[model samples]
Target: MKSSFFSILQRIGHAFMLPIALLPVAGLLLGIGASFTNATTIDSYGLQPLLGDGTILHALLTVMKSAGSVVFSNLPILFAVGVAMGMANKEKQVAAIAGAVGFFAMHATISAMLELNGLLAPDALPEGSLGMSVGINSLQMGVFGGVLVGLGVAALHNRFYRIELPTTFSFFGGTRFVPIITALSYMFIGILMFYIWPSLQEGIMHLGALVNRTGYAGTFIYGFIERALIPFGLHHVFYIPFWQTALGGSEIIDGISVSGAQNIFFAELASPNTQQFSVEATRFMAGKFPFYLFGIPGAALAIYHCARPEQRKLVLGLLLSATLTAVLTGITEPIEFSFLFAAPVLYVLHCVLAGLSFMLCHLFDVGVGQTFSGSLIDFILFGVLQGNPKTHWINAILIGIPLFPVYYFSFRFLILRFNFKTPGREDEGQETKLYTRQDVNAAKAQAQKGDQVSNLIVAGLGGSSNISHVDCCATRLRITVINENLVDDEMLKSSGARGVIRRGTGIQVIYGPHVTLIKSNLDDCLHNAV
Candidate 1:
C-alpha cells in the first residue's frame, strides 16, 4: 500500500514537470521586460530616452512583459492541460483537450452558481472570495482548481480512453468518451466547489497565515527538505505547493490579491506601484541563490582539489564543466550526485548549510525571485537587474560570497578527513568519472544508426517484457518493472544514464535535463518495436 501511494506521488510529480518546464522561459520574458520597463528603474538609471514610455524599446518590452504575464495569468488552464496530458498513458492529446474543456466547464458552472446565489459582484461576497478564472467569474481556486481538474480528468481518461460500449453508442466509446465524461465530471465538481471552496479558501488563507508566523525557522525547514528530496526526485512535489499555493503565503499587490510565494513576487515585479519586492514571498526563493550559485561550485572545486594527484588531470575537465553548469544554469545534479552517492554525510552537511542559507537570507531580507532554478541568468534578470534597492540583491551576493569558502573549506576537510570516495577518490577502476567515455560513445554510435539508446535502455531494464509502464520527470526516466531481479543497473548506466535508482518495483534512470527528449524517442522506439 505504501509503495503504491509512493508510486502515484512519483507519477504526479513527473506529470508536473510538463508545466514546470515552461516557467523558466515565461519568467525570463517577464523578468527582463518588467525590469527595463519599470518607470522608477528607468528614471533611476537615467535611461528615459532609451526606455521611457512610447519609445520603441519601451513598447517592445511592454509586449514582452504581457506575453510573459499572460502565461502566469492563465497558469490554471496550462496546468490543467499539461498535467492531464502528462498523466495519461495513451491518447494524451485527447486528455489534453479534455482537460481544457473540463477547466472551462468547471469555471463556467461556478460562475452560474455565483449568479444564482446573487454573489456575482465582488462586493456581494467577502473580500478575495470572488475572483476570475480565465475571465469566468468564479471561486479563486488558483492552480489547485486546475490540478483538481487535471487529476480527475486523467483518471477518467485512463479508465475510459479504451473502453468499449454497445454498438448503438459505440461512437462515444474509446478516446471520444474521455472528454465527454470529463466535462460532466468537472461540471459537478464545479457545483460542489462553489458551495465548499469559500470555506476551503478561508482555511487555506489561515494556513498561509500560520506558515508566515513560523518565520525564519519555517524557511529553514523548507530549504532543508527541498534539497533532501533531490536523491528521491520528489523535490518538485515537496516545493510546488509552497511556490504555487497558499501554503507559502499571500499578499496584495496593485490591489490584486496574490496567493503563493512566486505569484506574489512576480505580481510585484509587474506592478508599477511596487516600491520594493516582498521579503515574505522571496524568503522562499532567495535562499537558493547562495547555495546554488556559489556554494555548489565551491563543493565542486573541493572535489577537484582533493582528487588523487594522478587522477587530478583527468577529473579537472569533468569537475570544471559540472561546476560551470551549476554556477551558470543552476543544474547541480551532476556535481550533487557525485558526492550524494559517495559521501552522503557531505550531502547532509550541504543540506544543513542550505537550511541556514534560507534562514540567513530571510534574516537579511534579500528579495530575489527565481523563474525556476537559482541560475546566474535568473539571478541577474530578476535580482541584480531589478536593482539593489528594490530586490536587496546585493545582500544575497554578500551572503553568497562567504558561502563559497564555507563550502570549500568544510567540504575539503570532510573529504580528506573522512577519505570519502568522491569522484577521483574512488578505488582504481571502480567508476571514477561520472560516466565512462566508452559507454557514452557506444550509445552515441548506436543512436547514429537507429533508436539505440531506447534499445539499450530496454535491454538494461531486463527487456521490454519486464516493463509494465514508462514515464519521466525533469531528470529521470521513471519506469515500473514486473521483475526487479531482471533489472541490470550497470547496463542502465552504460546507456548514457548518470545513475539508476531502485525502490521496490520502481526504477528511475537519471539522464539530467534531456530526459524528456529521451522519453519521447523511447516512446517512439517502443511503439515501432511493438
Candidate 2:
C-alpha cells in the first residue's frame, strides 16, 4: 500500500513537468519584450528608424508589446491547461477539454456574482461599475484555482471514464463523459471562488504591504523564505504578494504601501512620474544574474571535475545537461538535487550565495525580472526594458565572469575538504555498475528455477512490514524504512542494487531508470513474504 501511494505521487510529479517546461519559454519571451519596451523608451537615441517614419522600428515595438501582453493576460489559461495535462491518466484530450470548461465556468461564475451584487446593492453600486471577469483571466487567476481544476478533472476522469451508462445516455459514455463531468464539477468551484477569492486576494495584498515595509531587509527575507519553501512547492504563496500587490507601486491597501521586486520593477518601467526611482530601486532583482548565468554552471563544472577519474566521463555528461538547463531556463532543480541530498553542506552554500547575490544586485541597483530565475535570457530582457537600461545594467555580464570561477573553485575545494559522497566520490568498492543483458537474463532464468534472490532481498530489507515508503523516479528507488538498520548492505548488493545511500531519515537505492520495474517486483516479493 505504501509503495502504491508513492507510485501515485511519482506520477503526479511527472505530470507537473509538462507544464513546468513551457514556463521558461513564456518567461523568456515576456522578459525580452518588456526589456525592449524599456530600452526603446529610455534609450530612444540608440533606436533609430530603419526606413521612413521608422515603420520597421514601430512594428518591432508593437510585436514586443503584444508578446508581453499575451503572456501576462493568459497566465490563467496556461495554468489551467498545464494543471489539466499534468493530472490526467491516459487521454490528454479529456484533460484539455476539462481545462477549457473550468476556465469558462470560473469566469462565468465571477461575472454572475458581480451582476448579483449590483442588483442587491442597487443605489449602493458604484457608478461606471464593470462586471468581474472570471476563470484564469490574468495573473490573478492564482495557482490555487489551477490546482482545483486539475484535481476536479483527474477525479472525474478516473471515476467516470469506464462507467457504463444507460442506453439512452450511451452517446456520452467513456471519453465523451469527461467534459460533461468536468463542467459540472467546476460550477461548484466557481461559486466557491466567487465568495472566497476576494478575501484571499485582500489578505495576500495586505501581507505584501507588511513585507514591503521591511524595505531591503524585507527583500532579503522574501528571498530567504522563497528558497526555504521550495521543497514543499509552496513558494508560490510567498511569491504572489510581491508580484501582485501595490507595495512596489503607488497602489495602497488599508492605507499601506506594498513594494516587492516584480512590483517595483514594473512600476519603474511603466510609471512616467516614477521612472527614475524604478531605475535605481529595481536593482533588488539584479544580483541574481551571476548566480543564474555563471555561478550554477561553475558549480556543475566543479562537481564534474571532482568526480572520480574513472567516473569523469559519466558525471561530465550528467553535469553538462544540468548546466545547460540552468543557463537557459533558470530551472536549477536537476543540478541542485544532484548534490543537495548527498552533500547538504554544498546546498547550504548555494542558498547563501543566492541570498548574497540578490543583496549585491539590490545594492548596485541592477534590476530585472523574468518569469523564471535570473538567467541570461532574463538579463538581456530586463536590461533592454529598463528606463535607464545602459546606466543600471551595464556591469551585469562583467559581474557574472568572476562569479563563475568563484563558484566553480569554491565548490571543488569544499567537496574535497569534506570528502563528500557527491556522485562519484562514494567510498571504495561502493560503485554499482549496470548488469549485462546476459547477466540479467541469467538472473531471471535462475529466478524461475526457484533461486531466492528476490526473497533474500525482501528479507534483508526487513520485509514488507518494515517498508514505510517506496517510490521511483527516472534513475533511483526512493525509499523510507521503518528501521534504517534493517537494510543489509551485502544482501542488497547480491540482489542487484547498484548502490545504497542513507541521509537523514531516508534511504535511496540506485538501480538506474529500470528502478521502477524493479520496485514493482520488489513490492510483490515483500507482499508475498508477509
TM of each candidate vs. truth: 0.96, 0.66
Range of the 10 consecutive residues with the lowest summed lDDT in candidate 1: 435-444
Candidate 2 residues 1-530, lDDT tens each?
Answer: 65444434444544454444554565555454444444345356565444223466556755665665554444445557666765565577777777878777776666666566663353443221222224222223344455567666776777777777999999999888888887877787777876776666566556656755666666666556666544433344455434533333333222223234454454344333444444223534566677888788889888878889988876776677667767875666567666765687887788777766666666566656555566667766667445344336656666677778988998999999988877677778865133233345655664676546667666667776777666554445656677777887677767766556554235566544345556676666666666
Candidate No. with top lDDT: 1
Error of 2 at 291 (Å): 1.7
Show model 2 residue runs off by greater than 4 Å. 1-17, 27-45, 51-54, 57-61, 119-143, 214-218, 221-287, 297-325, 328-338, 384-391, 394-413, 422-530
* Cα RMSD, model 1: 1.9
TM-score of 1: 0.96
**For model 1, how does the per-residue alpha-carbon lDDT over 142-218 read when each residue is reduced to its tens digit?**
88888889899999999999999999999999999998998888889999999899889889888878878899998
Q: Give all candidates' CA lDDT scores.
A: 0.86, 0.59
Clash totals, every prediction: 0, 13
